[model samples]
Target chain A: MLRLILKDILIQKKTLLTAFIYGFFAIYVFGVKYYTNGGFVAGAVAIGYLFITYAVSYDDKNNCHIALNSLPVKRIEVVLAKYLSVVLFGCIGIFTMIIDGFLAELFGFAMPKNYVAINNVLMVFGVLLVMYSIYYPLYFRFGAVKMNIVNVFLFMTIIVLPKALGEFILNHENNPLIKEVLNFIRNSPKSVIQILSFAAVALISLISIGTSTRIYKSKDF
Target chain B: MSNILEIRNLRKQYDKFSLKDISFSLERGYIMGFIGPNGAGKSTTIKLIMNLIKRDSGEIKVFGLDNIKNEKEIKEKIGFVYDENYFYEHLSILEMKRIIAPFYKHWDDGTFKKYIKDFNLPPSRKIKDLSKGMKMKFSLALALSHRAELIIMDEPTSGLDPVFRIEMLEILQSLIQDERVSVFFSTHITTDLEKIADYITFINDGSIVFSRPKDDILESFALIKGGKELLDKDTRKEFLAIKENSFGFEALTDNTDRIKKIFKNEVIIERPTLEDIMVYTVRGEIKCLDSY
Candidate 1:
């Protein structure tokens, strides 16, 4: 199974190269403009998510599921192998970004505080966990073709809702105490809160994996 | 008696077409040709037996074990080749072997090496760089090198040229010498099956139209060509299909011996080829005539 997973990754070497190039350009632009450690972490997390999404979508498009099913391996092993590949790539992307971040800092670029950097890393991972939690099951049920459209809609909702709510909360002029509390929450200890958020995200990811696996076992493929 | 594979009442339904109750068994050391037209549920039945697709209702036994319950064990001994090449296009054949070698317990590097030499495959070239015949030969080499007991192929020879097709059939013929290896290959090329298969299973409209020994089918069915006067309504019922022109008529019949006795000197009896039987069976045009 490990060998199969590695072969799949190797097969998509061109896609990986494209992803890496895009990541480099995107991160370099962010580093030049924003020049914050938090931005690096955010960039790394985004790239990781993009990698997972591309890998899953490619496999779905090529009917790799059918090919894999024809092999001697069990269905469960196939699923687990996919998840492991995502994790493996995620770690590699994160590590590469960390090095890139440090190099920028060494070259006299402005950087965020260490606490902010740490918090950004945690938040990025949190977002990825949430995104994968929702998307994996959707992909499993509806397939990549349909899920791509659904994903666009879901992404729009996620981005739009938070801004709308934030504006709504801020416009309430009569609630001075609520404003103060919200401000404090926003400015709280970056590391501790980030850790808590990541823990929650990890827990949610586990639940999603369990749910996806159950659905997959019952699936006709 | 230790049949390599057995399928009982296998059924799967789709919106377009459904596989009716289909059943067949392949004994050890024999090649079974699964002959069918396009959309005849040949591939679907293979998928169900391999557990790539789930059956709506049926029992599949491979190597004397339940296919689904003991799929891993069953798969371990079976090697499969799809109609098209499914390997990663960017990887070289050698890279693919490295990746797949660990999956099978009996993978023999020496045997794999021998196949590479026999097939004359360039290990360093990526799969996409190879021709269709080369790609298929590579797939065959992989399927055979793992000490597999059963090889299941879906139209493995459909796209190859005549030379490669014959070569592939020859390799399969040699593989069955041990009496432990069995092959179930589906193909539209009846001539290839005629040359290699010991048993033949004909599928039409998602149903098994005929399944019997190749020799038996050849011996039992025949073609009769005679003059237009032979085309009486009564005799037409006995033929599977018939073509009539101004001068004469040629009919295909399953009961060759009986028909020979009935038409003694009026018609000429000749051996019917597998292709003739397939065409006649599919068109339902067999007819009999009284004129010579």
Candidate 2:
């Protein structure tokens, strides 16, 4: 399983440099001008997303699944490796953000303050895990070429859904249900919310791994 | 245990094609040439053996264990080469090897280096930059680097020049001489098989036409030439397929001795090549209809 994850990294080693460049640019733009908290989180999430997509695209472009399946590794191992790679890429993304911050400070460029908080890192991981939980099973079933349109649609939805939901909440601030939900979130213990969020994301990731494995097991190459 | 690979009543179905209970076995230390025309389920059957695809029914056994139950164990002992280069194209040969070597239990770096030197493959070159023949050699080098007991190749020589094709056959010929490694080679190139294959398993339109010793098949199947009148409805039963022209008729018969007895000295009986058997068998019905 480690070998599989390492394989993904090795294949995308060239892209790692581009990820660093993109990370610095995102930090400077989003950190200095726009949303302050979102800069590092957005940079890390984008880097992680880029790594996973590049790894999967290379495999699909080369039809390497046949070679992978022909090896002594189990299909479940392959699926688990992909899931684990999200964590690896997440780490790389975090490291990229920190390095970008250091370079920004060294070069005397303006950047956001306290961008790498524990909450922000946790949020980055949570968002990535949930997004990939939705992407992988579809990728395992339909493959990269067939899933291209679905991927674009999914990216669009992700971009649009948050703003749309925020607008809906703002417009309904006077509603009793909205006020009750807001009160519950405000009154909830921080640790409890953290535990519950972890549990929910972990559950989604586990289910995604299971679905992807089942789909990949019977797949014809 | 004597058979290195075995498929019994194996079946798969697609919208346009299906394999109908195909069965074949390759004993240890022998190269079984799997021959068929294009889209004859040769690659599909190979994929089924490798468990690359799911089979609807029947069992596949490798090294005397159920393929699915022992896939990991079985794959460890099996090395495979496909018609196309499936390795990551952007990665260097050395980098790809780094990824694949850990997957095999008995991967020998020395053996891989030997193949690299012998095949003249530059390890630093990216896979996409290599020519088609070079890519195949790299695949073979990888397949052979591990201490694999069974090597399954699906059309490993399909698109190569004749020189490279012969070289590929020569490599297989030498690999099996150790008497421990067995090879299952699938190809539409019958001539290559005739030169190196010990056993021949022929598949046509997802069905096994025959699986037997190469010499036994060659000796038994005959090509007969005679007058068109000699090919009556009753006499036609002896031939698997027949073709007629202005000179007269030419037919293929598996029962060569019986054909000799029936035709006596009136017809000339000639030995049939593997290509003759495949071409005649696959085109037989259509050719018969065309002649009528």
Candidate 3:
């Protein structure tokens, strides 16, 4: 499983370098200038997504699945390796964000507000888990080529979802159910929310991995 | 476990094509030439043996263990070469090797290095930089480096030039000299098998035409040339397929002794090559209808 994940990362070494420079640029111009912590969240998500998707496209481009399956590795290992790769890239994304933060400070640029806050980290991890949880089963079923349109739709949903939710809350501010839900959230403990959020992400990821393994095991090369 | 690879009544169904219940086996320390025309279920069978595709119904055993139940263990000892280059094109050969080498339990870096040098493959060069022949050599080098007991090659010589094909054949020949490794080589190119294959398994239209020792196959099948008048409906049944022209009739038959007994030297019986057997049998039923 480690080798498989390493293979994905090694093949994208050039892309990773370019992404580092690009991440710094984004955090500098768009990150610091725009919505403060949102910039970091957006940058990390974009880089993580780009890395995993590019690795998948590389496999599709070269039909490496056939080669990989012919080796001693199990089908479940391949599926797990892909899920693990998202985590690896997410860590790399966060690590790069720290380096970018330092680089910005060295150049005398103001750092984004609350860039490394625990909430931001949790949000980034949650968003990645949700995105991959939805994306991977479909990928394992339809493959990279057939999932192009679906991928765009999924990415668009991720970009538009927060704004849509905010608008819904504003539009329904007078509604009793909405007010009650907002009050409950306002009264809930921070640790409880964190535990619930972590549980939800873990549950979604487990289901996704199960679905992907089932789809991949019965697949023909 | 004399048989290193075995498939019994294996089947796979696609939209337009299906591999009907096909069965064949290869013993240890011998090369079995899997010869068939295009779309003849050659690759499908190999894929089934490798468990790359799920078999509809049947049993496939490799190294005397169930293929699916023991897939990872079975694959640890099986090296495969497909017709196309499936390695990451952007990565160098060394990088590709690094990724694949850890999967096999018996992966030998020294053996891999020796092949890289012998095949003249630049370790640092990207896979896409290699030519077709070079890419195939790179694939063979990888397949061979792990001390695989059964080497399954699916049309490894299809697009290669004659010289390189011969070179590949020589490598297979030399590998079997130790009498511990067996090769199951699939190709429509029958001549390569003629030189190195110990047994031949022929499939056509998703069905097995024959699978037997190469010499037995050659000895059993005969190409007979005779006047068209001799090919009546009764005598034609003896031939698997027949071709008739204005001058004479040339037919392929497995029953050479029966033909000799019936024709009484009136027909010319000659030894048939593997190509003759494959072509005649594949195109058999459709060729000689008008001659009747």
Candidate 4:
């Protein structure tokens, strides 16, 4: 399973190069203007999931899933390798950004003013886990062609959902439940939310892994 | 002979094409040629045997164990080559092999190096840089290096010119000389199999037309050519397929003695090639009243 994960990363190393480009671009942007810790981290983190999506495209192009399955590995292992690889890429992405930040400072570029917050990093990771949890099952089921269409819809939804929810919460400002929810958000410790969010993402990711393995097992080459 | 692979009542259904109940067994020390025309469920059956595709209903046993239940063990002992190459095109041959080698407990570095030398495959060449035939050699090198007991190939020689095709067939023939290995290969190119296969399992549409020894098929199956007057509704029933025209009519039959007895000296009864069986089985029946 570890080997399979490594294979996915190694095969898609060419695409992973773009994440460096994105990091350099982020460094350039931070140098010129206002860059918060959150903003710098977000720029770095966005490209982490691209590793996974790109690997899917690589597998689709080369028909590697069939080749991999033909070997002495379980279908579930291949599915799990995909889920685990996102975390690996996530670590690599964040580490690259840290290195890039130090280099930018050394080269006489302005650095983000704020320190990296543990709570914010956890939140970002939580969101990534949730997105990947949902994304994989869809990719496993419909594959790259149909999933490409779904990705656009998903991107639109991601952009629109927060605004729609914000409007709903404001519109219901007078409601006792809405006020209680706002109170919880205001009063709860950030760590508590982060831990709870991580738990939820873990649960969702487990469910998605199960779903993907089932879909992949029955998939025809 | 101990059976290395056995499949029974295998079936997979798609909206357009389906594999009917397919049953064939390969002995431990010989090759089985899986022959069918395009869209004849040959590759589908191979995929089912590999468990790369799920079968709707059937049983496949490799080395006397249930294929799905013991997939890892079965696959560890089996080497597979596909019609198309499936590798990280950017990875050098050594890197690609490094990724695959850890999976098989029996993988031999020495055997791999020997094959690389024998096939003249450069260790540093990326897979995409190689020609199709060279890519196939690379795949075969990987397949053979693990000391696998069974080699299952899907159209392993489809695109190769005659030279490479013969070379590949000869390589496969040499593998079986150890008497511990078996080969099951599917192809539309019948000549490759004609030169190497011990048994032939012919598929048409979605079902097995015949699964017998190659010599039996070569000897018994025949083509009958006769005047157009000799071919009619009653006579046509004797042959599996018939192509009729004004100049003459040719038909294919598996029962040569029966066909010869029925037709006597009135028609020409000749040996049928594997290609003839495939063509006639796929085409089944054709009509040509005019000689254009």
| Model 4 CAPRI rating | medium
lDDT of 3: 0.89
- Model 2 chain B weakest 10-residue run by lDDT: B283-292
TM-score (C-alpha, index-matched) for candidate 2: 0.95
Alpha-carbon lDDT, every model: 0.79, 0.90, 0.89, 0.83
Of the two candidates 1 and 2, the one with more favorable lDDT, higher being better, is 2
The DockQ scores of all candidates, in the order shown, are 0.47, 0.89, 0.86, 0.68
Q: For this target, which candidate reaches the highest TM-score against the unseen true structure?
A: 3
Docking class of 3: high
Clashing pairs in 2: none
- Model 3 lDDT tens row, A1-221: 89899988988888778778877876866577874777677778777888888999999988899999999989999999999988888888877877888888799888866778878777878898899999999999998999888887887798679989999999999999999988987899988878988999999999999999999999999
Worst 10 residues of 2 chain A by lDDT: A151-160
Task: Mark the regions of model 1 whose C-alpha exceeds 4 Å error after superposition.
Answer: A14-27, A115-122, A149-203, A214-221, B285-292
lDDT of 1 by residue, A1-221 (tens): 79667755665666655655655564566665665454555566556666676667756764667656766788777766766665666665666676665665687766556623545555556566676688877788788788877776665554356568778787884598877867876898967665776688778888887877877766765
* Model 1, position B174: C-alpha lDDT score: 92
Indicate the worst ten consecutive residues by lDDT in candidate 1 chain A.
Answer: A115-124
A91 in model 3: Cα distance from truth in Å?
0.4
